[model samples]
Structures are given as structure tokens and as C-alpha cells.
Target chain A: MKTRKKVKQITADGFKYAFLTIMLVFAAFPLIQVVINSFKTDADVKTMPIGLPEKWVFNNYRDAWEIGGYARAYFNSFLVGGCTIVIVLTVVGLGAYALSKLHFKMRGFFTAYFFVAISLPGFLYIVPDYFFMNKIGILDTRMSLVIVYTAMQIPFNMLLLRTFLGGIPRELEEAAKIDGCNELNSLLKITVPIAKPIFLTVALLVFVNVWNEYLWSNTFIITDELKTVATRFVKFTGEYSSNMARIYTASVISILPVVLLYFIFSNKFIEGMTSGSVKG
Target chain B: MNNNLGQTALFAIMRNKKVINNMKKTSIIPYLFILPAFIIHFCIVTLPSLSTLAMSLFEWNGIGNATFIGFGNFTEIFTEDNVVKIAIINNLKWLAIFITVPIIMGFIVAIIVSRIIKGQMFFRVVYFIPYVISAAVAGKIFTAYMNPYYGINVFLDKIGLTSLGDTLWLGNPKIALYSVAFVDNWHWWGFVMVLFLGALQQVDPVLYEAARVDGANRIRELLHVSIPGIKPTIAFVLIMTVMWSFLTFDYVYVMTNGGPANSTEILATWIYKNAFAKYRAGYANALCVLQSGICLVFYFVQRYISKKGGMEDED
Candidate 1:
């Protein structure tokens, strides 16, 4: 009986390992294949999508960089992401501080408003927003994307920052006030430094969302010259349909920044993202 | 230069005021604090969203002058448009697939990842790498990988599966939506798994211990103790999945653009087509209102269920 139990344990362990290995392959195979094939020639990829090349070729990256106009795409994406980070942090920072710390008449109403706003689908407003941008003559500009993205991010990131600030002790700011710091000064000086980690987390999250944003960027920014990395990649893939190697290579380049950031700050990414889900 | 001069002057003026005046001065400070974020969100999101109601009642091309047509656009969606029905059905299918497949896959992976002591972080990060990839990039990657000529088909052909290898994964009408959903799930389930892993780690160890003491096997413990411990997270995940499924556009837009007889056209894509491609911005707003109305109904239904279930949803 004891031997039978031991046999059952081994089988269970084996099953677990089998399942995990299958999952690992499923998650990593396509990506690993893309990476491998990016280094090979187009003929080689057509022949063997998963295999290594006979003679490794690095021409795809250089060809894709020039052909895809990746320098401009990366620059535009960085500009949009940078502007969004600065705007969202300062604007939402003050708003979150108010919502969490200060007493106002419409506090509850604003909180509920933000909650409802978060659920508002982007498609609903994006149509009219398109025309509105045209009216303002901001169409085909990256700043058009910056404004839309900052607004789309405000509600959730505001609520997120509010929740983070709620945990900080009120006594810290009060002590600063007693020592002659004003209200705005107390926020900038005392509370903000203590809440720097959450702020950085919010910044990273906003930057990722901006970088990955497609619908707004696709719709509003019509010119190829102004396309962000994500939209530029779609156009690139279409233009390079006959060359899988260049298409996949461009994709790897577009995802490199976020992926590298994820490797370095995976915890912040996971925490900032899942916190919204859990709290929702 | 460091701070706004207007704000600096307001603080400077308030500093010398009496206690009663201080209270009055401070009450408006919060409003001042919230003004910048509020103004931008209001002009961009809130105004446009509320305008959809008004925009839906008009018949105007984007560049033309507006003509008021009450209830005309709404009725036309049900009567005139053929794609709206298919798009809604496709969205429902999307909801069904997302809530079931990824949720289950994520839960099971979370369980396994949570159990492993060594290399747990490795599995977690590897699984999540796809989720970090943009939809445009992920779709292109899959577009290459699923292409009949130069992708996974090559491997299948090498292994002597000619029929499977030759299949046009995104071109076939029958499987196009599912194919797109598969690419989306490739980038989605890792997120689900991470969320579930987060919820799982918060589960009490004592409950698992008690289940073990009660002679519960692993599957039994998973179904009984582990599942129940993460019930709120599961519900939250389902709610978000419902929301996201309704709003899914990036993958389909990038991969096929709702092509091949519009087999993969979901509501968002259809709405985008009407608004942009067809130049019927007014009609698109009507469709947008309809789609958002569906989401709002589901949101309320989830809220009611959570309230009825006595789920401790503090947020």
C-alpha cells in the first residue's frame, strides 16, 4: 500500500512537470521563433520558421530600421510617452492629493464620476474626438495623441494614485504644515517624496499604455511621419507583406523598450496593472 | 519659476488672514488642486462621451453641415446596417471565449506557478512577456507565425502535415475571429494569470492545510478551498474580461481589418468602419452609443450580482 502511494506521488509530480513544460513552450515558442527567424534570411524563414540559419545574417535589422522608418517612429513614441508621463503625473498628482487628502463639496461626486469615466469605452468618444481634433487643427500631430492619451489615463491613474496616497499617514503633511509649509508646498515637499514609489509606478504604467496605444494613434494621427511606434508597425507590416523577416524584425524593435523596461521593473508593471483589476 | 505665480500669490495672501478666513480660503484650494486634470478629462473624455447622445440624433458627414434627424440613426442601425448584428454576435462570442478560456487557463497556471518554489519568478515573467507586447506587434508576430507560406505552416509541412500546414489561418471566414482571438489571448492570458497569481498568493495557507487535514486531494482542494479563496478576484476578472471583450479592436484591426467578408468584425471595428471608412460619423456615434449601452448594462448586472453575493468589493 505504501509503495502504491509512493507510485501515485511520482505520477502526480510527473504530470505537473509535463503540464508546466507544455505551458512554457506555448508561452515562449512563438516569441522564440520570431527572435530566431529575425536573424535568418527570408528564404530560410520560408523553409524553416523554427530552425536556426545555416549562416546567421544580421542584415534584417538594418534593412528593417531604414525601410520601416523606425528612428522617427521611436522618436515620436518617446515624445508622446514623455509628454503623457509629465502631464499625467503633475495633473493627476494634484487631483489625487485633493481627492484623498482634502475636504471638498463634490469629493464623493468626483470620485464616482472618475469611476464611471474609467468604464467609458474609447470608441464611444473617439469618433467625435476625431472631428474635434480636426476642428482644432491638431490632426496628424503627435500632440493630438498626447492630449487624448493623458485624458484616457487620468481617471484610472487618478484613482490608483488616490488609493496609494490613502495609505500614507496624514500626520506627515500635518507636521509639515505646523512647521510653516503651505498646502501646495506640503504636498510637493512632504507627501510627494514619501509617495515617490507609487508615482513612479504610475508613470511606468502610463508610459506603457501610451506606447501600446493603437486606436487613438491610428485614427487621429493620419500622416506616416507622425505615427507612433505601434501604428507605424501596422503600416510597416502591411508594406512589408512579402518579407516576413523584415516584418518580424520591425516588431522586435518596437517591443524592445517595453520588454526591457519590464525585465527591469516587472514588479512595478505587475503591481500597477493588477491593482486596477483587483480593486475594480 | 518653480511654482505658478497665481498659486503663490493666493497662498501668500491667505497666510496673513484670520482663522475664519483661513477656512474659507482652504475650501476652494481643493478645487484649485483638481482643476487641471479635471479640465483636460472633461474636454477630452467627458464632453465627447456626453456629446455622443446629441451626435447620434443627427445626419451629417464629417465635413458637411449637420442635419438633425431624431431617432433616425438609431433605427437605421437595426434596420439598415447588416454588419451591426454580426458585430454584436461576434462581440458576444468574444465575451464567451475570454471569460471561459483565459480565466480557466490563467487559474490553472497560477495554481502551478504558485506551487513551485524554485524558478517561480521565471515562469511568471515568461508568461507575462506576451502581455507586455503591444497588440500591433503581437498581431504581426502571429501574422508571420500563422502565415501559410513562411510561418508555423512551414514547421507543420516539415513534419508531414500538408493539409494543416497549408491552411490560411486568418483568411478563412469560419476561423478568422477565433484566430484573431487566439492572438489576443496569446497576449491576454498572461495578464489574467498574473492577476490570478496575485490573488492566489493572498489566499490563506491555513485553508489549504485544513483541506489537507480533511483528506482532500489536490484537485478537490483546488475546487473547494483554492477556488473559493479567490472568488472575488475571479469575479473581478470576469467583469474586466467582459469590459475588454466589448472594447477589443487592436488585434482585428491590425491583422485583418475585419476582412474576408467581415467575419471577424466586432462592434468596435464596425463602429470604426462607419465613422472613418464610410464617413458616417453621426451614424457611428449612434453605434457607439449602442455598444456602450450594452457595456453599461453588463456593468450594472455584474454590480448587482456582486451585491447579491455579498462579495466584499470595497472599491
Candidate 2:
């Protein structure tokens, strides 16, 4: 009986491992294939899609960089994403802190505002938003993208930061008051330092979302030189289709930085996102 | 002198009564802090929304003044457009797959990942990496990969499995929608896994140990403890996926561009083309309003179900 059970258990474990390994391969296959394909000349990719190239070629990257204008696109993405993070964090952090920690008569009203904003679908406003941006004379500029992204991000991030703030003990603030710290001083000197982990998570999350955004980038940033990586990449593929070599190269370059950032920050990003949902 | 000073102090206090009227005045400070978010939300989110709603009452090209059309645009959308019908049907299909597949895959992956002690973080991050890539990039990559000439299609063709590459995956009207959903599953399953993983970590280990000592085995332990552990998270994820599936635009727009007889048209993309491309701003807004209403109804229904479940669990 013991021998039979041992054999069964071993077989089951083997099956489980096999299943896991298969799934992992499937999950990783596209990334691997793309990375490999990006290095191949167009003729090689067409001939042998699944296998390694006969020789490693570096010319694709050079041609793609020059033709795709990825350097300028990267700069634009950074400008848009960076400005969005800074503006959003400042506004939403202050707004979230006040909403969570302050005692005010209109707190209910502001809370309702956040809820309604969250519920409003992005499509509902895109047409009007385009018109409004035009009226304001900044329709195609990176500033428009920054402001719009910041606006949508604020409600979600504020709600997240509010939950984090609410978890911190009120006694800390009272203690700070006894030590002659005003509200702003207490928030800056004490709360901000302790909330660094959550803040970083929020900042990174916002940055990634802004960077990965496509629709708004497409609609808002029309100037070719000013387009972000996401929107520019689509146009690059379309314009450079005959030069399939360069499109693959551009695709690889576009994803590399973001992928690296994600791998590095996945831990905090996952925690921050899940915690926001649970606690808030 | 005492009477004069006392009377002046009483008057001063009385004059500031409006400011001191509220007992929870300190609570007002939170609202003050929340004001900046509100202002920006107004300008960026709310104001545009109202204008969109107003525009739905008019017929106009973006360049010219919008002509007052009232419900004409809405009528035209529901009555005239075959593509809108296709879009709604495709959206329903998306909603169904969106809810079922991710939650199932996420749960299964979470279960597997939980049992593995080594390389858990590495596996988790690798799964989620795709989620961070923009839909445009993913669309491009997948379009190439699924291309009949050079993509996964040709690989299948080479191994006497040309039947698998028989259909134009994105170009075939019958199978195009499913192709989009399949790609979406790839982009999304990892995210759902993260939610499950978070819930899984919070599960009490003692329960599992107890199950083991009782000879409950792996399957039994998963059925009893793991399922219950992540029940709420699953529900939340399901609701969120439903919402997102309805709002899906970027993927469909980039991948199929609603091609091959509009097989892959979904609500968000349809609305986008109508308002922006077709220059029917009013009709598009009407579609948006309808979509929002459906979404709101689902949101509340999910909330109610979760609340009731919470009560049951508490009991």
C-alpha cells in the first residue's frame, strides 16, 4: 500500500510540474520571439520565424532608430509622463490628504465629486475634451496630455492615498502638534516620510499608465515630432511597413525601457495596486 | 470698565458666529485639501463630460457650429446603423469572455504559483510584464506574430498544420472577434493573477496545515481553503473585468481597426469612430450615455451582491 501511494504521488507531482513548465513557456514565448525577430534581417524573419538567425545583425536597430525617429519620440514620452506624474502627485496628494485627514463641512461634496469622476467613462468626454483643448489653444501639445492624464489619475490615486492616510494613527498628528508643528509641517516632516513606499508606488503606477497610453496620445499629440512612443510606434509600423526590419527594431526599442522598469518595480506596483483596492 | 470690556468681548464673539457655527469645522479642512483634485477633475473630466452631453443635442461637424438636433442622433444610431448593432453584439461577447476566462486562468495560475516556493516573484513579474506594454505595441507584435507569412501562422503551416493557419485570423469576419479576445486574454490574465496572488498571501496558513493533518490532500485543500480565501477578490476582479471589457477600445482599434466586415467592432471603438471619424458627435454621445448607463447598472448590481455576500460571511 505504501509503495503504491508513493508511486501515485510522484506521478502527480511530475504531471503538475510539466503543466506549469508548459504554461510558462507559452507565456514567455512571444517576448522571446519578438526579441529574437527584432535582431534578424527582414528576409531571415520571413524565412525562419521561430528559430535563430544565421548571423546576428545589428543594422536593423540603426535603420529603425533613424527612420522611426524613436529618440525624439522617447523624449516626448518622458516629457509627457514626467510632467504628468509631478503635477498629479502634487495635486492628488494634497487633495487626498485633505479629503482623508481634514474635518470640513463640504467633505461629503468633494467625496461625491471623486466618485462621479471615477464613474464617468473616458469615451463620454473624449469628443468634448478635444474641443475644449482646442479652445484652450493647447490641443496637440504635451501639456494637454499631461493635464488630461493628471485629471483622470487624480481621483484614483487620491482614493488610494486617502486609504493609506486613514490607516496611519491620528495620535502621530496630535504628538506633532504638541511639538509645535503646524498641519503642513506635520504632513511634510512626518506623514510624507512614512508614506514614501505608497507614494513611490503611486508615482510609478501613474508614470507607467501615462507612458503606455495610446488613445489620448493619438488624439491629442498630432505633431509628428511631439508624438510619444506609444502613438509613434503605430504610425512607424504603418509608414515603414515596406521596411519591416525597421518596424521590428522600433517595436523592440519601444518596449525595452518600460519592460525593464516593470520588472524592477513589479513588487511594489502589485502591492500598491492590490492594497488600494482592498483598503480603499 | 469691567462692564464695557465684557460687553465688547460678547459683541466680538457674536459677530464671528457664522465661522464658529459648525462643530465639525475641523472636518472642513479635509474638503479644503480635496479641493484641488475637484478643480482639476472639473476642468479635465467633468467639464468635458457636460459639453459632450450638450453636444449630443446637436448635429455638427467639428469645424462648423453644431446644429440643434435633439434626439435625432440617438434615433439614427439605434435605427440606422448596422455597425452599431454589430458593435453591441461583439461587446456582449467580449463581456462574457472577459469575465469567464481571466478569472479562471487567474485562479488556476494563482493556485500553481502558490505551491511553488522558488522563483515565485520572478514568475509573477514575468506574467505581469505584458500588461505594462501599451495595446499599440502589443497589437503590433501580435499582428506580426499571427501574420500568415512570418508569424505563428506560418509555423503551424510548416508542420502539416496548415489547416490551423487556414483562416485569416484578424481578416476573417467569423473568427476575428475571438482572435481579438484571445490576444486580450494574453494581455490580461497576469493582472488577474496578481489580484488572486495578493488574496492568496493573506490566507491563513494554519488552515492549510490543519487540512493536511486531516489528510485532505492538495485538491481538497485547494477546494476548501484556497477558494474561500480568494472569493472576495475573485468577485471584485470579475466586476472590474466586466467594466473594462465594456470600455475596451485601444486593442480593437489597433489590431483589427474594426475590419473584415466589422467583426471586431466594440462599443468604445464604435462610439469613437462615430463621433470623431463620422462627425456625428451627438449620436456618439448618445451611445456613450447608453454605455455608461449599462455600466452603472452593473456596478451597482455587483456592489449589492458583494455587500450581501459580506453580510453572509460575517454571519
Candidate 3:
């Protein structure tokens, strides 16, 4: 009986492993297929979609880079994403600090406001936002994208940072105050240094979201030169619909920065993305 | 003696005045710190959102003079617009698929992964890799792979699965939306699994051990212990899935562009087409409002259910 039970336990373990392995493949295969196909020529991909190229041709990357105008799109994405992170961090950090630490009358109101704003769908305001941008003549510019992204990101990041700040003991800031540090000095010296983890999480989250944003960027920035990586990628595929190799290559190129960043910072990426949901 | 007393009194008053001034300065500092975020959020999000309601009531072609026709756009949406009806139906279909398929897959995978000790992190990172890639890239990858001539269709054809191989996945009106949903889910479910795994880690292992002591099998333990353990997380995921379903756009837009005669037109892409492509901004604004209304309904319903559940626990 003991041996039979032991065998059953081993079988259960085997089943678990088998299930996990299958899931891992299902999750990883399509991405692997894309990466593999990106190196093959169109003819090679056409003939063998699942296998490695007979001879790896590097020109697909070059052609995709040149014809898709990915360099400009990359630069534009960086500019917009970078500026968005800076703006969101600075603005949301201050707001979060105030909400979490300060004693104010409207704090509750503002917190609820942000909660509602975060829940509201983006499309609800997108049309009016477009008109507002056009009316101000910032349409088709990187600044418009930056401004819109900054606003869209603030509500969630602020709430996340606020929760982070709330967890920190207030005694440290009080001690800083006793040591001749003013409120701003206390925040800068005592709070900011300790809140580094949350700040990094917020920054990485904002950067990824801004980099991946498509609809607003597509709508607001119509000029080809100002187009972001995502929008540019869509247009690139449309323009080169027949060339599967270049399309796959361009898709890989567009996702390379984000994917590499994600792999390198996988822990932080997972933490930030799941922070709000898990905590809630 | 009198002169000295008066001098001390004067000094005390000066100190009090300084304290008052400092209090005022500190009070204003929080406002100043919060101002930039408030101003930007208000201008870009709050103000525009408020304006959408007014815009929906007016008839204007974006550049021309605006004319107010109260509920005219809303009337047209319900009475005249066929795309709006299709969009609403498609969004509901999306909601149904998302709430079931991803949640079930995520829950099952997460439960299994939670039991594994070795290579757990490796599986997690790999699974989540697709989620990190942009929707546009995911869309493009799937589009290429679904191409009848060169993609997975070829493999399917060789495997004697000729029906699926020959079917125009994205080109077919019946399958275009589902095809896009599948691609989106491919990138999505893994993230959901990771979330569930995180929640699963918080579950009490002692309960699982107790179940084992009671001679519970794996499936029995999962149904009784693990499912109840992650109930709150499941509820949260459900609420978010509902909200996101109404807002989904990137994959459909990039893959099919609500194509095959608008068969795949979810509300978001439909709104985009009307506002940007067809130049029907007013009608599009009404559609946006309708989408938000649906989301708000879901939000309140979730809240009500959770609250009732919480009260039951108290009882």
C-alpha cells in the first residue's frame, strides 16, 4: 500500500511537470516563431514557417530599418516616453506625497476623484482631447503625446506611490524636521531616498505604457516624422503588406527595446504590473 | 521692572507672529506641490471628459460652427446606426470570452505552477514575455502567422487539419473578431496567470495540508481550497476584464481594422472610424459616452456584489 501511494505521488508530480511544460511552450512558441522568421528570407518563410532559416539573411533588418523609417520612430518614442516618465514622476510624486502625508481638507475629495478618473475609459475623452489639441495647434507633435500620456498615467501612479508612502513610518520625516529640515527638505532627504523602489516601479510602468501607447499617438500625431514606434509599425506593415520578412523584421525591431528592457528588469516589470491588482 | 516686562511681552508677540507666518507658509506648500499634477490632469483628462458630454449633444464637423440638437446623436445611435449595434454586440461577445477563457486558463496554470518547486521562475518569466511586447507587434506577428500562404495555415494544412488551414482567419467575417481576441488572449492570459500565482502564494498551505489529511485528491483540493483561497483576486480580475473588454482596440485595429465589412467592429474601433475616418465626431462622442456608461454599470455591480459578500462574512 505504501509503495502504491508513493507511485501515485510520483505520477502526480509527473503530471504537474507535464502540464507546466506544455503551458510554457504555448506561451513562448509564437514569440519564438516570430524571432525565427524574422531572420529568414520571404521565400524561406513562405516555404518553412516553423523552422530556422536555411541561411540567415541579415538584410531584412537593414531593409526594415531603412524603408520603415524605424530610426525616427524610435527616437520619437524615446522622446515621448522619456519626457512622459520625467513629467509623471515629478508631478505624481508631489501629488502622491501630498495625498499620503499632508493634512489637507480636500485630500479625500482628490483621492476619490483620482479613483474615478482612473476607472473612466480613455476613449470617453479622446475625441474632445483631439479637438483640444488641434485647437491649441500642438497636434501632430511629440509634446502633445507627452502631455496626454502624463495626464493619463498620473491617477494610477499617484495612487500606487501614495500607498507606498503610507507604508513608511512618519517618524523619519518628523526626525528630519527636528534636524532643521523644512517640509521640502524632509521630503527630499528622508522620503525620496527610502521610496526608491516604488519610484522605480512607477517609472518603469509609465515608460512601458507610454512606449506601447498606440491610439492617442496615432490620432494626435499624424505627421510621419513625429509618429511613435507603435503607430509607425502599424503603417509600416500596411505599406509593406506583401513582404512578410520585412514586416516580421520590423515588428521584431519595434519590440526589441521594450522586450529587452522587460527581460532585464523582469522582476520589477512583474512587480509594477501586478502591484495594483494584487494589492487590491 | 515694568520696562523689562514690556520688553519680554513684545518679544513674545514677535515670536507668535513668526509662528503664524510659518503655519501659513507650510499650509500653502502642499497646494503648490500638488498643483502641477492637478492642473495637468484637469486640463487633459477632466476638462476634456466633461466636454465630451457637451460635444455629444452638438452636431459639428470638427471645424465648422457647432449646433446643439439635444439627444440627437444618441437618438441616431439607437435608431439609425447599424455599426453601433454591431459594436455593442461584439463588445459583449468580447466580454464573455475574456471573462471565461483567460480567467480559467490563468487559474489552472497558476494553480499548477504554484505546486512546482523547480524552474518556477523560468516558466513565469517566459510566460510573461509576450505580455511585455506592444500590442502592435503582437498584432503584426499574428497577422503574418495567420496568412493563408506562409503562416501556421500551411502547417495546419500539412497536418490534415484542412478546414482551419483553409479558413481565412481574419478575412472571414465570422471569425475575424474571435481571431483578434485569440491573439490578444495569447499576450494577455499569461499576465493573468502571473497575477493569480501571486495571489495563490498568499493562500494558506496549511489548509492544503489539512485537505490532504482528509484524503482530498488534487482536483478536490483545488476545487475546495484553492478556488476559495483566490476568490477575491478572481473577483478583481473579473471586474477589470469587463472594463478592458469595452476599451479593447489595439489588436483589432492593427489586425483587421474592424474589417470584413465591419464584422469585427468593437465600440472603440467603431468610435475611431466614425470620429476620424467618417468625420462624424458628434455621433462618436455619443458612442464613447455609451461605452463609459456600460463600464460604470459593471463597476457598480462589482462593488455591490463585493459589499454583499463582505457583509455575509461578518454574519
Candidate 4:
């Protein structure tokens, strides 16, 4: 009986390792391949797509940067992403404070409001908002995206931020209240400091989202200069369709910033992504 | 004594007015705090969505006058739109794929990773790497990687899978959507696994030990112990999967763009085409209403089921 059990254990371990190995390669192999192909010349890429380059020709990235207009893309991405994070954090911070701490009529109603907001699909407003933005004459501008992105994220961010704010003991804020601080003052002085971690989490998640978001921005932002990496990428591939290497290089360029951030903040990314999947 | 009584009544009236003024001042503070977010959210998300009902009742090219044609757009979509039928079917396919494949994969991986005592984080972090890549980047990479002449086909041919290797991945009408979904699932399931792992850890090991003592095999442990333990999470995952299945746009849009004769066109992308490309905002709104109705109904039904099954508490 012991021998049979031991045999079963060994087989399970073997299966576990085998499955994990397959997944590891399956998840990461294409990413590694893209990076590998980014360095190869066009001929080399087609001939040996997933293998090492015969010579590490670094010009593809340089060419892609110029051809893809990556400098403008990067600047636009940061501008949009930074503004979105600031706006969402500030607006949702105050709103979450009210929901979590302040006494108000329709408190239950407001809670239910955001709860429903969480379930509403982007398809609901996405196209309509384009016409709305067009009517307002902000259609091609980066500001349009900033506002739309902020609105879309507000409910989910509100949900997470309110949960965090609620978890902070009421005593902490009451201490500020006893200090003769006004409500706004108490929020800024006491709650913001204690809730810094959650704010950071929200910011990180928002940054990634704005950086990665394609559909709305693709429709709204018409100008080349205003397009972010996510939007520029489709155009880049089309324009540079003849040169596979440059497109491959552009793809890597698009991915690296997020990958670098993930490498630095993997734990936080995981935490934010899993916890902030309320919207998803 | 009459003068004293008059003065006391005046004092009480003055105090009452002061109290009312003070109450008004403090009560507006919470609304003031929330007003900015509320205005932005309402104008951008809620207002547009609400007006969609009215929009669906009208016939309008986006920038023109909308004439009221009650139920015209709705009738047209149901009776006239072939692409929508395809989109609805694709969205259902997406729902079916998501609920089964990723949930099972995530659950199985989480169980195995939990069992492994060493190097668990390494396995998790690696699996999650693909998820961080944007849909555009993934689509671009996968397109080249799945290229029949030079990509993974080359690798597969060497491994003796000639038939599978030679097929057009995103070009074929039949398999295009599924191919796009495969990339999405790659980017998706790891995050699902992490959620499942989080849920699994919250399940106590004592139950597993008891199951083992009762002479349960590994399959029995999975079915009896683990599945029951993670029932709430499973329900949550299912609900999200069904909702998101309808929401899927990025992958198909990036990869195939509902191409090879609109084989991969889901509702969201079709809505985009109608509103933006066709200039038929009213028709798009109708589609939006249809998509929301499906998701909303499913969400309620799933919640109802979960409640009946005692899988989750009512919020």
C-alpha cells in the first residue's frame, strides 16, 4: 500500500512539473520570440523567426522610433496617462471619502449607483461619447480621451478607494476632527496619508489601463501626434508593413515600458490587477 | 410679566432660525465632495447611456437631425442585420469558451501551484508575464508567430504536426475568432489563476487532510474538497466571464478586425462599425441596448443562482 502511494506521488509530481513547464513556455515563449525577432534583419526574421539573429542589427529600433513616431507616442501616452491618474485619484478620492466617511442623504443610493456603474459595458457609451465629444468639438484632442478615461474608471476606482477608506478606523479621522479640522481638511490631512497605499494601487492600475486602452482612444484620437503607443501601433504596422523587422521592433517598443514597470512592481501589479478586476 | 413672555418667545424663534441655517450648511458638504466626480461620471458615462434609449428610437446619421422613428432601429437590427446575428453567435461562443477553458485551466493550475511547496511565486509571475502585454502587441506577435510559412508553423512542421501547421490562423473565416480568442485566453487565464489561487489559499488545508484520510484519490480531492471550497469564486469567475464575453473587442479588433468576411465580429466591434463607420448612430444605440440587455439579464440570473446555491452573500 505504501509503495503504491509513493508511486502515485511521484507520478503526480512529474505531471505537475510537466504541465507547469509547458505553461511557462506557452505564456512567455512568444514574448521572448518577439524580442529575438526584433533584432534580426528581414531576411533573417523570415528565415529563422524564433531563433537568435545572425548578427544583432540594432537599427530596427532606431528606424522604428522614427517611422513609428514613437517619441510623440511616448509623450502622448505619458501626458494622457499622467492626467488620467491625477484626475481619477483626486476625484475618486474625494468621492470615496464622502461615500465611506461622510453622512449624507442617498448614501445607499450612491453606493448602488457605483455598483451598477461597475456592470455597465463600455460599449454602452463608447460610440455615443464619440458623437458627444464631436458635438463638443473635442473629438481629435487628447483631452477628450483624458475625460472619457477618467469617467469610465471612476466607479471602479470609487469602489476600491471607498473600501480602503472604510477599512481605515474612524478614530483616525475623528482625531483630525477633534483637532478643529474641517471635513476637507481632515480628508486631506489624515485620510490621505493613511490611505496612500491604496491611492498608489489605484494610480498604478489606472496608468496601465490608460497606457493599454485601445478602443475608445483609437476612435477618439484622430491626430498622429496625439496617438499613444496603443493607438499608434495599428497604424505603425500598416505603414511599415513591408519591413517586418521595424514592425517587430515597434511591437517591442510598445511592450517594454509596461514590462519594465511590471518587473519592478510585479507584486503590486498582481495585487492591483486581481483586486481591481471589479470592473472586468 | 407680559413683556418678559414676549421676549422669551422672540429668543426661541431666533434660535430656531439659526439652527435651520446651520443644518443647511453642514448637509451640503457631502454632496459638495462628490459633485465633481458625479458630474463627470454622469455626463460622460451615465448621460450618454441613458440617452441611448432615446437614440435607439430615432433615425439619425450622427451629425444630423434625429427624426423620431419609434422601434424602427430595433426592428431593423432584429430583421435586417445579418452581421449582428453573427456577432451574437460569436459573443455566445466567446462566453462558452471563457467559462469553461479559463476557469478549468485557472482552477487546475492554482491547485497544482498550491500543492507545490517550492518556487510557487516563480511559476505565477512567469505565467502572468503574457497578460501584461497589450492586446495590440500580443496580436502583432501572435500574427507573426502563427504565420503559416515562417512562424510557429515552421516549428510545428518539424514536430510532425503538418496539417495543423499549414492552416491560416487569422485568415480563415471559421477559425479566425477562435484564434483571436486563443491569444486572449493566453493573456487572460493567468490573472484568473491568480484570483483562484487567492481563493484557494483562503480554503483551509484541514478539509483536504480529512478528504485524504477518507481514502479519497486526487480526482476525488479535486471534485469533493477543492470544487466545493472554491464555489463562491467559481461563481464569481463565471459571472465575470459571461459579462466580459460580450465585452470582448480589443483582441478581435486588433487581430482580425472581424475580417475574412466578418467572421469574428462581436457586438462591441459591430457597434463600433455601425456608429463610426456606417454613421448610423441610432442603429449602434440599438445594438448597445441589445448587448446590455443580454449581460444585465445574465448578471441577474447568475446572481440569483449564486444566491440560491449559497455561493455568495447579497451585497
Task: Report per-candidate DockQ.
Answer: 0.62, 0.53, 0.63, 0.62
Who is ahead in lDDT, 2 or 3? Answer: 3
Query: Candidate 3: where is the Cα deviation over 4 Å?
Result: A277-280, B1-25, B302-315
Shift of residue B152 alpha carbon in model 4, Å: 2.6
Kindly list the per-residue Cα lDDT of model 2 for residues B44-128, writing each as its tens digit: 8888788777777788666578789778877887888888888878988998898888778878887878877676887787777
DockQ of structure 1: 0.62
lDDT per residue, candidate 3, B52-169, as tens digits? Answer: 8889898877767888999999999999989888998999999999989998899889988898888889888988887888888788889989897888898888789988889898
Measured over the true interface residues after superposition, the C-alpha RMSD of each candidate is 1.8, 2.6, 2.0, 1.6
- Candidate 1 residue pairs in backbone clash: none
Q: Give TM per candidate.
A: 0.93, 0.90, 0.93, 0.92
Q: Report the Cα lDDT for residue B16, model 2.
A: 50
CAPRI-style docking class of model 1 based on DockQ: medium
**Ranked by DockQ, top first:** 3, 4, 1, 2
Which lDDT tens digits does candidate 4 get at residues A14-101? 9999998898888888888788888999888877676789999989988999989999999999999999999999999999999998
Off by over 4 Å in 2: A1-8, A276-280, B1-31, B210-217, B300-315
At residue B88, candidate 3 shows an lDDT of: 89
Instruction: Give the per-residue lDDT digits (tens) of candidate 3, residues A153-210.
Output: 9888988999999999876886676577887888889999999988998888888998
